[model samples]
Target: MSPGLKFIDFSIMPVLLGAGSCRRFLKTRMLRKMTIKHYSSNRRSNSPDNQYSTIAEIKEKMMKSFGLEPGYTTEPKSREELLKYQPKFEDLPARSMQDSFSSAIIPLSTDAVLQDKYINFRGFARLGRLLEDMDLFAAWCCHRHLKVPNLPEGVPLPYSIVTVLVDRIDFTSVSPNGTQDIRLSGHVSWVGSSSMEVVVWLEQVVNEEYQKITRALFLMAARNATNTAAAPVNPIQPANEEEKVILAGGADRKKQRQILSAQSVFKVEPNAEEQSLIYQLYKRTTPVEQTGQQRLLPPNCIWMHDSFQMSTIPSFPEHRNQNNTVFGGFLMRSALEISWATAFLYCKARPQLEHISDISFQKPVSVNSFIKMTAYVVYTKENYLQIMTVAEVLDAYTGSRVTTNAFHYTFSAPDPVTEVLPRSYHDTMWYINGRRKFKASRG
Candidate 1:
């Protein structure tokens, strides 16, 4: 075995068995042993144990293992080239849930060097970094579910799978220790013509039993090779009653998303209850006197304007994906970190992450671009805080800026946090939106 490599047998077959069954079990055990040996040999050849490997180095190696070349752009250089290869728009073969099921084990327990990449200052796993892993795992599951027609050998995939939304990520337990190994498993639960919903679970072994720590739902869209138009993907079929229920839930979520989009504040006016709530909030900051004067601030409330935190990061090539654009996972990690910082400063205590919802990737960020992330505590209820984080890409040449992504996070403060009071119409709309999202997440 490779240095520091430990083989863990997860099988739990009972010892007391009939003679006929015993022979079969012994055969199975021999096959499993051979498989483990082969896997270990591959691991030693591909990725030898290295204590000095940096995260970038490990990530580059991983991309290569996935058949993606680092620093290589697969997109067509010109519109004419993109037009040369037209994508077919035909029905694809239906796939079963089992076909897309996949799982991975991160050997943090045995790999001390690798654990350093994910550990935070407090010796606990960094949730933001874990988000990156989850995003990548979801993309892998999507790829596993898709199957294209006969194409040239050693050619790139004809479709570009991109994460469009993170429906929700719920933390069911406390942050895990860096010493425990992590198991990521999931499958493509539902699919539309060109969109898919992936469900992933993060678990760790506790007393030799796997315990789920987080469950995430991601919405991905498949685009053409050039990423200019939508591309159809294989449909997924349920194999049993359990899978059928899961598929139904995904369909319901899709409808709910459509409804929410239709009722967005930007598309339609707020309902009666929301309007009343906004007026009441306005009154809290307004003085009773009719004379024209400045608004009065509530004793225990903080103005939304004062609860803003901003950070600018220079995007590097190390964070770029195969398309030469910054990876979606890196964007998510950056936004989550900044939002967590904003919440910590606002509440004057360490906030525990409860839910991450409605993360929308509007545009892609190019390598070497400057990303400006702005976060604000938009709403609060009791000890809970709803934060809205916006990421904008700035052009160094034209000095122009464009919004790239928007992320929403809900956190529970150790103590009661000061309410965030809006001062302008735009802030009020954000407050209302945050309130709605927070309520939905809690439910």
Candidate 2:
């Protein structure tokens, strides 16, 4: 599309999934460089004496090509006016769930609260993190209550909340007559739910130059006490790693619109062709609770243990530098794709169950390595089922393990199309298989 046509490309970041992390989206494609031929026929009217450049320069040019204004600008602020616009969201008092069931609402923070200078970021990225927080809270709640059992070797929980949007925002900052208190105030309205949307707003203020964030609202989705089917595996917090980029001026990752509504849950179905592909991976990786400790088939089946796609592959060549690993949701999305694909292969009666917060990444897959992955059936309840994923990073040449991790996925009932297909060869047989492919490095 031409720049004058649509501006949607100006926004939205395509998700890039690494082994265990989800990085933000770049403005343009991450493939081979994009080159544009800026042709001007009239030499006198158009400056014709331009220079030719490499594809790298073309990428930079593309950054400026689309008729878009630069997002960040630094108009020199007057020392007097620097105190304004310090905080984007103001703090408000929070209502408790006790108030909710009672049909009462309470605010969390107040006008006197303050804000600090925080890690600076634009809109989409900020909302993306808020969503991640939502996922963390949901997972914690699930883990505390629901626990899926008979786990095949190597699988763990990776349940998380996906960021959808910033429903509301309010900013409060001011410059008093002659005072010198640079302050910040605001609140973020967040919607949390799988199908039934539960919305909450958090009030926050800056302190001490914005180095820390103190919660003015502590909230979580209500647990389904009636459905005591399994123990919940998710906790109400983000992963325990704190990192910062040295030069962190990267574009935002993404703030996708919520596709699955708040009331929805994951469903699964089995098919033949999908069985063949995954049957090659998950035939014999069943859980073995030998000597009271749970393990994989072949007793300690590493083959079935390292088949999930939660890790990255290092480069085969010496010079290649692309290593894709970031946030956990990207990996979960990939696993869901594979889970559905694998379910079609072996399932006869039920689709598959996709339980959350049961995935664990135990190792880091470095740049340029081959990946080994596997999946297997653990157990079933009614039509809801659970499968295990074992993912590992490996040396392409020596076949040595580089990193290993595991996860458990849930699938639901079969669909109409799945009911029609005859059982594939993989439906009856089982074995844990793994493979890898070679491709050129990403530019």
Candidate 3:
């Protein structure tokens, strides 16, 4: 038996339900009774038994309840047919923040079976699964905020929502108990003509009070039905003083992102301070008596090239989303797992995840493709280790690869970790980038 199979007891035949059986139960009973109104508030209630429902299941039911379906243009045979369904930005009306507000509940406390699905081997709720939930929930909120006008009956929604970037995910409290109920709530905090910023909160119910565990900021783009062009989304205006502050924060984050992009190492040379730092690192790692020999590594230090871990994964259909591509959440989970492993190998001990930030989804991974993830320990300060993981999709025919995503994670080790030194100019840039992220995450 597989190690994970130990969590399940085959002796309890009634508790073990097949996928078809679970789907039937959800469709017949849960889907028929649950509605968005039931989940509009954060207060716990004697709601119907929905402990078996996943985020995807809940999203599907909610969309159907609202008389909406996955937005796709009917087999556009030509360019003219596709252009006919192109979305118009001028027609979309401005909306208030309250209009897009939403909430969801994962009743892990009441459902042992559901808890089993989210619990990790260490007994904490899996952060990757939570990430998947956040991505789906953010898209759901965006759909709620969108208001496309004048569509005929039986026609699907005229917009396709896609996650473009995860600006930051901060964990205020790590180690969420697997047996506790979790609440997810958020809204469209800011919006442009074609893009929107969603802020989602993950909280665990402790003593009947919701305690925040993680707060995530996701950037999503709206596209036309066929996802060929950008689609305009309803603008969001602040309804209260607090909301105004939130909106301003979003604008600041947008501006900050622009600044960072313009200052990327690939775009320009490093400033004097950064150059000085890189030279210092080079000197420290170089041998004083150079006889055309490799420098001896100092005690408690390892080269960044030596601190890498890699894995290859086949993009299975089960991980695909409505867009017929690999789900963003699945990619995030895989990256986290590999990064965690990289940190473990570098530290020679288990490391506790401090936070995750700047997870960028550069491209979509197609089903049946293979993903190659490479993780390296690029920086270490005191007991903190920063791991950077890059995910790329490989072309089977040409044997070339295109990067799909990049992930940065900060973990705390039990003891001071061995220092990771840069060996080349390329590795030096990664080291500097990691240092910047580590400092920002700490602040």
Candidate 4:
């Protein structure tokens, strides 16, 4: 028999009852109850012992709470098959948002064997790993809402999904330990002709109450399985007033994105409003002589090149997803860490990710290629620090580099930040764009 084949016994069982047998069964039942009670008592709310003391304890608690394990069955059952144990029929309409709304509650955990790699320097869960999980959840949400293809049945065509952009992610707060129960919920916020907006929210459950922690907006695109072109998706009909508002917001954001893309500071010329602002900024600009402690001009101003930090790491196969490129979540995590570290050093205090916007995936980084990431402090406003991070693929032999991603982060520090000034046109472009993104992020 092949390893892929699993078998189940269908033979009937004969039952024999005796006084001693009944007593044994009762004893087993009582023991199981006592064990569960003991476990529950030890992990009671507000108990110091409830917290995870080590990685092994976290793994044990998560396994008992969520029963999560890697690897699925040899082949996954289709949505219809899993729903009713029936084969899928031909010519089905696209799925609806309600079909994709899913929720789960579980205590966070670190894999015992891979604990070091899954945690950041602060001993908390790595943002990159969480991102990977969120990406998977978003994909599943979209898949659940997809209509069955209208094709002859033999083998279904492969499904292709990619995350084109992450509009905004706000990290309000995070638990310091993995012992807290986290509630994850997501649904399709809006649908375009071939695109979808997935709103995923992460919250921590404390004392039977939910506390919002983080939320992210992801823009995903569906493509034809054969040609990899834009594929038609089911149109979403807003079911209620709340949904109507959410859909309207999504549409408005889409429109704003289109307009901004065309009028971005990266262009050669600025618009009338931007031109006026630039003129005022340069005309009133006071040149510092690179001296005087209280001047707050030259000393506070950090050059993009001087403030730039770089890290080189190889793209391992473990980071690849079904699309055969590096996972977006991993990239996000790595980029965020670098930016946070830079912010932390500059502020002389801890910095938290207040907002991340316009994370664009320009291209996929190939497996086995070296990824060189650069982080620069693009702008600063009082307590807010904006860092622009770029990820590129570096060819060692040719010494060539090609950009793969661009991420913008706004971090709030405990103390005020020394303002950064753009000395050149290129730096000014980033500064203007960063300010624009900051405004949009506020909305």
Candidate 5:
């Protein structure tokens, strides 16, 4: 979208490009079948009654999963019905802070567990949150062009749609009638539709409170793309930040380099294989509850290999500050480097790798934090790779978080990338958002 402009949605739903032309999307068959899958699962329960996860049950499971505070009973709303306004956020009481998922929390009691710092838990929660948000964001973007309107921004994304949890939650201090600064630092390394890879670093500050989120920014990079000699006639574009620079150089060689400055792949959404992954991932994993809403979490599993260690230093000197601390630009640089590296590692299995198209900073991170970064190669095909990464900023002294972020990257193989075919999942998501009724498979 004009190089710098981007669309940022706070909820999870499929994305259709708002700043581009859907007509351009119609000419290609492979583009028609692309889908972004971020999470993974194998077992799904078909019991209609079972799909309804109670807030109490979600609370029990979450507490066990991440040491998070217990669930609170908010006034419940009727299901399958759309909302006309924002939901009321009632204050939760101190007693509701108990660990609902204690079986999962059992390990935290051991000396080895308390001091042991693991980042996988954050990855799980981040994956769930990103998928939920993708559902909303993507739907909203494509709503108008497809004849479906989407929810306005700044509203509460339904608990039925998205849920969030941190690895080490502290409610004992913040629960009891006291104001505390709740630090949430986490990152989703590689994300696609339905799943993600993430890590959460958290700390509760007594007498400190979390600032409510108000806005967000999304970034995309594309320039390096290799089209197969079989279809060499089709136009190809760059996919990585570096390729973009090279493209610009080539374009500048001929003229202004305007064409090369433009992004190659124009959109991001859930593809068929990705959708299958999502369906399978949630098929059996227990869901979390909040305000009487049942929300699903990524099933506990090792989807990405632990090949890289978290780095707090920037790869280059330009990113360091006067205090020798990493700057925000440096953090972003590190994030992309790590994400590309992780994606490259996964692509090695197939002897191929692609680049990222979009990135978003949910919040700011700082220096002196032993950041735990994770990335997932959620969606891959013959030549392209789509990766999502999450980075959590932490205060090493107390293991508290500075903030959270989610990034979406698109890569095209030596072949062209594809788009998703629309279905019921897309329709139901729109129905809940009070959007215009869609009649076609516009995915």
Candidate 6:
């Protein structure tokens, strides 16, 4: 949580806490059991029917989307062969925007989509799964920026890149089910001493035209494998005014983050402008006796931790990235899925992500570690709801847990929410900050 610490290092910390040691601090058994039950039910709702025709149909749709021919090579790329071609930073070849470009076509699994009364019927691609694809592409864009040549055998280059933040993602459209292909592409927009801002966009073909589904800004940091410390990233060369502008935007975002970290709303008193806004909010308040409105937080109001919570299956090999840790994109998707459920429950309608203010990976979660995700409705305004999801790793042996990732999401629902009122000063600060985010997003 210290400013000096860009992220938490779990390797140096004590082992995760045991379940018994963490019990009191966790949700009640009945609630947790229900959470698991609800998760299972959702999975069942989306499970595949195991029909051969269904699988074949999805595969054919994907191939067309990817523009792949029947005779295309299907052999797996060999890692050993790729490693032989690994190039050092300086030895890396020069690349243009097209050279750095890459894309993937994957079949959308039925089980990955969530069905809810509040969601639109046109499509059901889970936001978490969609984000996972976006993260991978952004990482690939950074890899190309480093100009690491492809190995003859498909071996990955020896280097490490990790996602530090998903600063923002604006969802512009939804990819429908009939439009099966999820297209992702990105390029390095800016570079710092050791950080690169990779901008990625998600798209799909609709009515014979490409529809942009989402555009995201991902902040990634390069590292040395030997020491696992920050390492310099390859600088980007802007070719046109558009690129130059994008590069500047990335730099500005970094500066904004620095300024925000230093003077977060929770850490300091409001300035004149912010104080004026707060005063306006207070002045607009009406007396409950006259307005016949609810006063204070209702006793039955939902607390963030009390509902829609679930722990992830232990991190596994299949989910590991080049760093041999759980993929950052996977974590992002996981958090989003749980937060979506939380928002849906509160709204009793469909909720869509409008903004992901930030996703800070405080610690790298190693493979096999257990993760518990908790979502809280920290603030709400009109039809927009601000949810914060915190991820922590539990040390089964030591019964210790350390917070690893914090994700802030803003969702817009069809209906206005029954506002969540803060009962304490700490809660009030968070509420005010949430409102600040809402206002900033509008601008």
Query: Which parts of model 2 have CA positions greater than 4 angstroms off?
Result: 1-327, 348-354, 415-443
lDDT of 6 by residue, 164-217 (tens): 888767777564453265555566767876777777766656665446687788
lDDT of each: 0.77, 0.28, 0.76, 0.64, 0.29, 0.62
| TM agreement with the true structure for every prediction | 0.83, 0.27, 0.84, 0.73, 0.27, 0.69
Q: Show model 1 residue runs off by greater than 4 Å.
A: 1-67, 72-91, 291-293
Worst 10 residues of 6 by lDDT: 21-30
Off by over 4 Å in 6: 1-96, 107-123, 148-156, 272-295, 298-313
Q: What is the lDDT of residue 341 in candidate 5?
A: 66
Worst 10 residues of 3 by lDDT: 23-32
TM-score of 3: 0.84
**Better structure of 3 and 4 per lDDT:** 3
Positional deviation of residue 237's Cα in model 2 after best superposition, in angstroms: 15
User: How far does residue 71 in candidate 6 sit from its true spot (Å)?
Assistant: 28
Candidate topping TM-score: 3
TM-score of 4: 0.73
Arrange candidates by lDDT, descending.
Answer: 1, 3, 4, 6, 5, 2
Report the C-alpha lDDT of model 5 over 1-443, residue by residue, as the tens digit. 11111232313322343211211122111111111110112135332122223322433443332222332223222322223322222211111001110100111112233223221332211222222222223222211111112334533222221212211111121221112212222222222122122222223223333221111111111111110111001111333332233334333333322232251122233445545655654453335333433433343222222323344541333332221234343444456566656655544432221222224445434343466676644443345544556677766578676546655444344443331111234432222111110111011
Q: How big is the positional error of residue 338 in model 3, measured in Å on the Cα after superposition? A: 1.1
Query: How many angstroms is residue 205 displaced in model 6 relative to the true structure, after the best TM-score fit?
Result: 1.3
Per-residue CA lDDT of model 2 for 22-82, tens digit only, reads: 2111111210011122233333433111222322233233223211132322331122221
- Model 3 residue 167 CA deviation (Å) reads 1.6
